[model samples]
Target: MVSRVLVPMDDSETAGRALRYALDVHSDAEITVYHVVGSPSMMMGSAVGLALEDDIETAATERAKPVFDRAHEVAAEYDTEIETQVGLGHPTRAIVARADDYDAIVMGCHGEHSENITRGFLVGNVAKTVFERSPIPVTTVR
Candidate 1:
């Protein structure tokens, strides 16, 4: 019954695991691999430079290429093809905004930069926020 499934991914092993899980569990559903590029920060991070480009949308897409490439590689392991999407701004907000179009959301419990030695929590901010705010069912893979 689930015709559409959304799997948010990044350049992380856990995200790859989540994608594989979705493919195995919902093989019949259309899968969309989404990657969100964080918005520019005042601290002049790489994202800020990317946002300053002539075309911000294109910049975002280019930044997300690595993630999408990995997603495609993973999808190939399952002998399936998946649609890829790139979003800008906060990861949680971007994903939640599109959650309504899918039957469910599947993602990693933490991301590439999720290791917070200061906070002592394993869950990434994006995953935590999405898990809390998503209107649709969310499945988080460790």
Candidate 2:
């Protein structure tokens, strides 16, 4: 009876797998593939030194499109509507706030990052922070 499911991903391999899992398991459900961009204000006072908030948001959306497109392609057999949502703010807060809109929250067990960026679930701060305050069930992928 889960009519809607949200899959928040940075469009990485593991996330791709999670998206695949959702589509395969819940073909009849509506799926929202989401990506969160850290607020420009948060980018400020940080080491990233990325000043182009607008540019980042644009690029992020464009980048996320392909990921969702792939999901759409794979979900063709099912009745799934794949969408790309770009959230501007903290990742966990945005996700938690929107969690109730969907029947469930499905996401990668481990987040996605660049080759140079370190990646791990509980070992990293992103996963840790989300773990501390996730209101819904979170299934972490390996």
Q: Which digits, one per residue and each the tens of the lDDT, describe model 1 over residues 1-142?
A: 8889999998888899999999999999999999988887666456887756888889889899999999998899889999999988888999999999999999998887774432476677888899899999999998
Candidate 2 Cα lDDT to native: 0.67
1-142: candidate 2 lDDT, tens digit per residue: 8888888877567677778788877778888888776666634443143345457667656655766676677567565568668776677788887777877777765665531376432433454455566766655544
Clash number for each model: 0, 2
* lDDT, model 1: 0.88
Model 2 residue 85 lDDT? 82
Per-residue lDDT of 130 in model 1: 94
